[model samples]
Target: MNYIDNDPRLQTGKPAGIDKISIWIHPFLIREPSAFHPSSGNNKKVILRYTSRNGFSIDFQAEFFDPFKNIFIQILEYLIGLSIRGILKSPINKDFSTVEKCFCTLFTDLFAIDCIEFYFDFMRGHLILSNITNQKYKTTRYSNNYTREGKSVIIAYDRIERLKYVNQMNYDEISSIIYPMRFEFKLNRTNCEYLHPTNIFGNYNVIFDNYLIFLAKRWRMYNQQVVSIPVLNNLYYAEKFKTIIQYSQWQFPYSMMNLEKTPSCPMPNKSVKLKDIDRNWAVQFSLKDWV
Candidate 1:
């Protein structure tokens, strides 16, 4: 999703009438050669390029939403998807309806969905919900472009060009050439519907708390397994960008949250079997083992 232009109306206490929905949703993939990429300008011939299932094919008119909105949507969606898969601990094949029901309940209750146009951001991520029924009342014109809070978060992905690795962050802090978002399914024009990946970050600490539990459990199951967010290699870096919380305490710049230590398995003490004068034999056997 792209930011088309800065509106003075936003300062004048008027609705910008600009679409900002793209800011919330980010797809799972980043398109090569960004919209502003030198090559992108040259390729603006208005030809019908087959839009990726998750990418937009609109002629980005200045009056229309900005191209940046497109990029923003793409990145936001990707982060959401990752959180669903990684944090919510949901499986991929779960029914879309069930996922949507759970998502709306959790997100709306937690973040106040009535005030936020997350679907627009989801669209940016190239995630299309098959059923738009849930999003019916949210499609206002200018309201789509701006949030009451002037500031917003962006999921700047890493290694989008090479691999699908990413780091969640605010827009101002991202430095790498990354896609704004990635979508789970390929784009389909006929249906024109999609849903975003379930995301965990953004103002909510519950996701972080849940992640800690998941991580600890996984670690307990297999201690040697590497616990990595890849992008969060160092605590200093995370602090600089204010990225997601790092699992390792040493890697966190601020006071990292501490998890309750897992209790150890208890060992049982043996009781003598009082059978047929077997006390002497049992004592002798136990003593031999100890010896």
Candidate 2:
């Protein structure tokens, strides 16, 4: 959805906008070099064409083209339709935009969308990615994310905890504001919509819509969950109980928070299950913040 420049809420990083994008162009297929149209002195031609070989690929922070007068966009659509293969990346962290940086390729291998990763940073619900879904697919978990493979592939993982080591942290120091526990979704060629060269912008909207639907459907599946405790689980549990016991004279003791042994997964127990599994991050999410 190419929107007007005046629309503030639909800024880049928002649901309708993209964080990073990769485009692959087959110059051999683009024989119509005369398609480019010129404009005013400074804002003239849209593309800075360069030959491509061994290399295949190629936004704006918000809107690449001003909806009002966009010859540049028109030329892009035309060229893309002629020869294009692309990878479109979207970030769940709308607050931090990471636009792609593509330069002309002479010897580099073509850019491939091996998979698309949707990072739900600081949010969690491991069970959802455990295999539950509205659509059926082979589900498997290794390393961190849940993966579904077929016409397309999707990978979901924990962002904060995975990066804990970068900050010199073990799971012992997690935060609720950074919760419920964020996840990342990785999608392959078949699953990504932003690859359509002629309609990258339009496809971006579809990508965002599909994501919101996936989350909404999963959220509606159950009002609560009985969860397995990981080192991360203890943190979620600790925060959840604080709210539950707020009125009780006896507060939940910090010592009872299972903080022994420095084991990453917390104390080993076979039968411990926490119910009404708290998704603190999702609980506080508002679509308005995105759109």
Candidate 3:
């Protein structure tokens, strides 16, 4: 399988100006020397074939011998699970979510590691750049009162204040304060798997989930006008809450706005033609009726 070095700097953990490196994974079948032995047949093997832009190539194979067998098998499984087909088929410039899912699944499911935390750490620099760009866009796109960055910052600040007040601690001490709270909640779980933080990965999972819930709650609180009402109860708010629910997964969309135009007047009591009604109002009414 071919693996291009689109991000070679990631491998060295440093920014280097180099052309793309070509990578290939091939089966390194080895035939036994003994002809009479039952295990004389070719043994299964795998090797990584790396080729630089200058045509310099190197082949490396893992020692799948006794002591390293288990760890090497896990690593191989992870590499295989990151579908080679997807990588080849994907466009040169891929979306963040696609890359995130591929790497997260490769690390989390195959290696039993907390890839999301690693992902956050890996993207911290990019995120800082993104925030700066987004702030500039917000400044240019909207008025002071309607600036998304201002609103988001205020909401975040308020959440931090509430956390400090409720936990009786400073902002820096919030993690220590919330750890016990999270532990108590996890203890309530009936499943033995979650009863204790058996390993670092397990503990990280708990921390990550709790952190997501905390952020979700803060977001919901900030956008109470859109989230307080049921997703089914209002079409306007449902559309607005879709992105929020995607991030949080704490709310459900029981009903959705009807983008399709009604053929006839759905409401009998109201002597209003479907076409005559305002588009937003008509959609909302139709959605309620459909639900």
The lDDT leader among the candidates is: 2
RMSD to native, candidate 3: 26.2
What are the clash counts of all predictions, listed in order? 58, 12, 0
Q: Tell me the tens digit of each residue's lDDT in model 3 across 1-291.
A: 001123332342111111111122211110111211222111223232222321111111122212112322333333433333232222133454543444333222112211111111111111111122234232111112234222221111122334554564566765433111100011111111221112122222233333343334434444432112232223321222233345555652222211111122122222334464333332212323211
With candidate 2 superimposed using the best TM-score fit, by how many Å does residue 128's alpha carbon deviate from the native?
6.4
Ranked by TM-score from best down, the candidates are: 2, 1, 3
- Per-model root-mean-square deviation over C-alphas: 24.4, 22.5, 26.2
TM-score, one value per model: 0.18, 0.30, 0.15
Q: Highest TM-score: give the candidate number.
A: 2
Candidate 3 has a TM-score of: 0.15
lDDT of each: 0.25, 0.30, 0.25
Residues 192-276, model 1: lDDT tens digits = 1121223223221332342343333322332222122333233221231122222432343222433222222111112323352
Error of 1 at 110 (Å): 19
**How far in Å is the alpha carbon of 255 misplaced in model 3?**
27
- Give the C-alpha miss distance for residue 24 in model 3, angstroms: 50
> Which stretches of candidate 3 lie above 4 Å from their native place?
1-204, 223-244, 247-291
Candidate 1 global CA lDDT score: 0.25
